[model samples]
Target chain A: MTRLEDMVGAAVRDLADSAPNAHDLASVARVRGRRIRRRRQALLGAAAVVLAGAVITPYAVLDGWNGGPRPQPVASVPPSTAPVVPVPSTVATAPAIRKDWWAAPVRLPGDLVVTSVGRREVNGPNGVTAVAPKTVQEGNVALDRSTGRYRAFSGGYQGFDGAPAGRYVMTDDGITAQIGILDSVTGQTRQLGHGSGRGVEWSADGKTLLLSLLRGGVRLIDAKTGAAVDREMPDAIALCPSYCNFTWLPGGEEIAIAQRDPRVERSEALPDTVRDIRVFSVATGKPLRTLPVPGVPAGSAAWSPDGRYVALLPDAAEEDGIRIAEVATGRIVATLPLVEQVRFIADDQILTVRGLDVGVYDLTGKLRQSSRLPQDFLGRGISLGRA
Target chain B: MKQSLEDEFTAFVADRGQSLLRIAHALTGDRESAQDLVQGALAKAYARWPRIHGDAEAYVRKIIYNDRASAWRRPGRRNEVTVAEVPDRAAAGRHDQDVTDRIAVREALLSLPERQRAVLVMRYLEDRSVEETAEVLGCRPGTVASQASRALNKLRLLVGDRPVSMGGAR
Candidate 1:
């Protein structure tokens, strides 16, 4: 073998060596043994004989009028008019406004099937409790507070509007975000961009949208003009080797992106090991500051409502817990241990969901209040505040 | 049919179980996962033993390929490991070893799109005929050839001049 080939072979062998043997052929043998036994028993019965020699055909002979079954002819009818509403543009090219949006107060389509539903309640920081209907399934229903209507955003996944102005992002596979604009009053639904990529964030004015593209960088869509602004960051700035998750500050002037340095050994195909948090000016697409975020996993990063402190769940235990870093100093002000995902409910209170319990934590990393969600509700989709 | 299947399954396991585990290891780049995959495939084949026993090894192999492909399809299954940054010189030196070379190959295999990887593994490493691979993968022979070709091209790109000749058997 060539030296290079030998080297690679050895490396592969080492990797294989490290793999646990618990998943070995014996488990399969046990399972297969049972199956084989069952199949043998089933085949030993008369059913096997019937299946093997099943040439038995059923023939129906019709003697009526000395004829076989005859085909019936029917009269053609005129096409019915339901006022075919033009198939609304799947692409959200036009400006997204309350008037321009299509499906408001949208009802669950008759053909829309509900996969699964369970009773669930979410409690926010300031004693804000919202109990959704027990019949709601994941990726199907969202409550639009403006219209007081439950709109079904059907890209196969559903989410509630945590932000105001009747907008919600539906994510399929928990990665790609499909932008949906629901009329707050009518529940009309219009989906924007198909597989345009994920990380859809609304500008503070709710006029612009931010989306991440697979090839590279992020796309800024002006919901008002339908003009898209592609802001290309250097390949070195890629959050993860594959993709980055983005969140817009309340001001929307600056966007916070959690990105990992791609030119590193990644533990998984995608790792939340975000080495840097970059705050970019939305107007110029110029990075305002590049702050080193040590130990933050590469999931979603939440900005404080005031936009002063950015919090991330640490991927490494020794680095920090809930990293409350100052945007200006790039200094980690506080670390809260064991916090996995964080969302800001108010200035002082933050909603932290770890496992099944959602707790409100202060900036100082103290738990204030906690609430229990029915098993797997938080697992489905989690967001703070009401739709 | 029942007796024939039992005999076939038992014989197939005795002949090919270890090899399946090895292939699973290569695919997962982890022994534990590889074992799990092999076991799962065996169970699936055993369950359909009456039908699968005609070509039990091929049937089990198809299950392995499908299982690996589905695992790749699952979202958030990729685990990212953080390695402390090594200086460029050290990194280059680290690649000089046999283990590093294997690591490179494993990574290259993992980097391929799942279907392409399955085709490449089944055709090249497992030494299955194109038609046999197509049947196992539930694809046309043409698709198997195309996927294998594409996969080889990708491996060439990743392995660079590492001599991944298809004819070479170790």
Candidate 2:
């Protein structure tokens, strides 16, 4: 035998000798056995129940009757007297139902068009707020597809529901002006800050707030004092004359913004073609670097942990795939093939909603599992948590 | 209904689970993942017990092979390769000769493609006939022969020129 063969044989033998505890194996077997037993029992019980129902139903029906003799049936009307109305196949056709109807009832509060919705749980002395019902909204704004319109509807009330108590920030009219802190016990909301912006992100420690100004640069605000920090992004970075979106990393030290560059591109209307992802130091507002996403026409960008990768998805009409760019090298690492829309579950896993099935796949292209959603929940967004 | 079948299953797992795990470990190259793969295969067999019990071992083996194959075809799914740590030569001195040999074989196995590796394990390690391996893999016997031939040739190159004696063989 060669050295490699000898070595492999040795490892296999060693693994067998020091095999892990049988507990896991036994547990798996036991679970399988239980499932088999339950299914068998259910089948047998169902068969017996059907048999019993068949035997007893006729007797019960006979016992309920007082009179045994029955009369013959009588004819009601002749065919000639009925109206001779012609039926048009075209007129009988049902109106085309809008595909967005099922998703219509979920409305966002008025005065606040929902920019995004994230599911979170808050924990407190109230013994874990009942995992809010499936339909409960987490963020403000209801985006309706019915009339292809965005309307603000009420009903999204933020509260502590088994999540760690913290002050949650909200943005108004693209400004970070209003902040609400939920009371851990009473589940009451208290206002904190006054700022306006399209986007707001809380720091990792929940001590600092980051907001993007609609006309220009980003602003860092003290979460407690509601005061703007002296640090403002440089004019070069702040040159976005129209729309800007900000995404924060977990560490809170950095934020990435997707904005149009006014200097490089100019148009009478907002230049739809101009888009870029720029990293900035949250404390200094100094631009760190601008990374261009390949294959992505650039509309929205989100950062992965360590800011090593950014996920870019174009507008709704564009084909879907996520581009991963290495921050240091700015080279494309991988372009994840996905359906029209996908939600990142973690750094490694993505939950993709395709048709009626929700597929879970790891970063490396392995499909872990898939589950079908109910018809009503088909068009609605899905949120996942450890059960 | 039969105590004997249950006992047989327990003994089968005790006797053959390691061998199955070795093949799975070779394919995934991770102990935890191999265990999951084995359990998943066994679960699938259990679900079809009435039909599978007659050939339970073969049924489970087929499931493991198919699952691993299907996983490789998914688009944009990347496989995370986790290599087992190589113990220091001095520390490994106390291990049995056979144990060390098995480890070397597993590492070499990991270098092969999913199909080639499965063919090798089923034919050489499990001592299955070419027809039997082909049946398990759902391929023609001729294809199995060709795959096994290619896999063995690759293994010869991977195992290198060092000579060692098989503990129980001539």
Candidate 3:
């Protein structure tokens, strides 16, 4: 045995022996899968915002490289140990939908038809105050390849003094303990306040904002007129995080909110905290729909475009896929195969993350096509232009 | 095929997670960073489970090497490498661990760059060949040869010992 071999063997063998299950790859995979899915969805949403910004921001539309060159994959790339090779000068496309999926940048129609609202828009900059395990963080924003869109993965809100204030999407940027609003038009930040530091979410229409006051419970405010729709949106269940999480329905007058009940028995699939999913009127704050709690805790609820069904992603516990339920009757219409994250592309089609690949699945849950993204695709750097 | 995706994944995690973490810890020289590196690689590997299941271990090992290789290129990351403390043979849970030799090896290995460190680990510790190491690292065989030669030469200089080369090594 060579001395080098002995040394390496000694080190590796010791490591293998002393190693503990510090973290599980399976669980880590599931978590990362969800993170990747979120990033993809954020990229998609940010692209739309950039598309919208193209109308408003002059420099945005003029950028030729944004979607000018058509991406075509080469047969093979020469091997290199370097992390970054020049952007290939030519974009690589996947071979086929099933064999190798590719998201090519095309001239997306100027008129975007959005069936559902998923993540907060990639509007630039924001602040957040997380109540649990209490800490403050400043937010940072990464602009999409398209113009005027940004994802505040971290860093805090900007542009408070002389900035236009429509309604900005806010998350917790704990450092400042200040809630910041990111302007949709210009990538600028403005402070809302330091106390109760979480960012308030905006309604789909951009008319309403969800606020969690440090003094008390949650409050819903009318953004345009600046009036409280409800000082206390009746957190009767107290199932909210530092802020509250609600799935906005089609009409925008109602939202499905989480109601916590410890007595509610749950399977390994459900988030342990959730006991029920309820829909309440934005106008009256009254229960409109009380979903039958599956033996599992359903966390993220996506109401279908036509208002026929609601898709529920169980709170992060297991890879128990999404559940599609009838809105009126609250019956589980269909169950999907295990997926890490899900989003709605068109009304009839849903996008899912199946490992590193993204699959387009129909309402019936049959996969229509799968696409392989560029190896380095992430929320901050990548966007797909649809034809 | 014998187990569900989750089951199989769980088995890999339970059975192989520790060893992978140790390798990562050795590479990173810190517990937190090692956990991060190993988990990140596992997550990437986990996503392709359906296609790569047959060679999952190798697939994951490739990711670890690549991730570490890539990290070396980043500006601020290289300074994080530490020559780990001298291991007490007793602390290593074995009577055979030669503290003097192991510390010498650790120092020599830490003295090299990340890519060299990765190449050396594969070639010497794991018993991989020039071609296999190149294949795993997505580099040319010539590149692997030069990297291995340089790393071994550095090790010999650092430790003042005859370095054994294993061509049929793996």
Best by DockQ: 3
* lDDT tens readout by residue for model 3, B1-170: 23587688778777887767777766654444466567667765665667777878887777777663223111112212223333323435334446756766665575566677777777655677889989877779888888877776766666554435643233
Instruction: Please list the C-alpha lDDT of all candidates, in the order they appear.
Output: 0.45, 0.40, 0.44
The best candidate by TM-score is 1
DockQ of candidate 2 compared with the true complex? 0.09
Q: Please identify model 2 stretches exceeding 4 Å from their true place.
A: A1-185, A192-197, A204-207, A221-230, A234-243, A259-276, A292-301, A315-320, A333-347, A351-359, A364-368, A371-387, B1-170
- Each candidate's interface RMSD, rounded to one decimal? 14.0, 17.7, 12.9
- Using lDDT as the yardstick, the better of models 1 and 2 is 1
For candidate 3, what is the DockQ? 0.14
**Candidate 2 per-residue C-alpha lDDT over A326-358 given as tens digits, one digit per residue, 9 for 90 to 100:** 444445444554332343333344444442345
lDDT winner, 1 or 3:
1
Show model 1 residue runs off by greater than 4 Å: A1-134, A137-139, A147-155, A158-184, A194-197, A204-207, A222-227, A235-243, A258-273, A295-301, A316-321, A337-340, A373-378, A385-387, B1-170
Query: How do all the candidates rank in terms of TM-score, highest first?
Result: 1, 3, 2
Ranking by lDDT: 1, 3, 2
Model 2 Cα lDDT, one tens digit per residue, B1-170: 36665565666667667667766664555444466567656654555555557787777777676554222111112222112222212334545544544554555565555666677656545667877877877779888878755655555555443354322111
Judge candidate 1 against the unseen true structure and give its global Cα lDDT, from 0 to 1: 0.45
For each candidate in turn, the TM-score is: 0.42, 0.34, 0.40
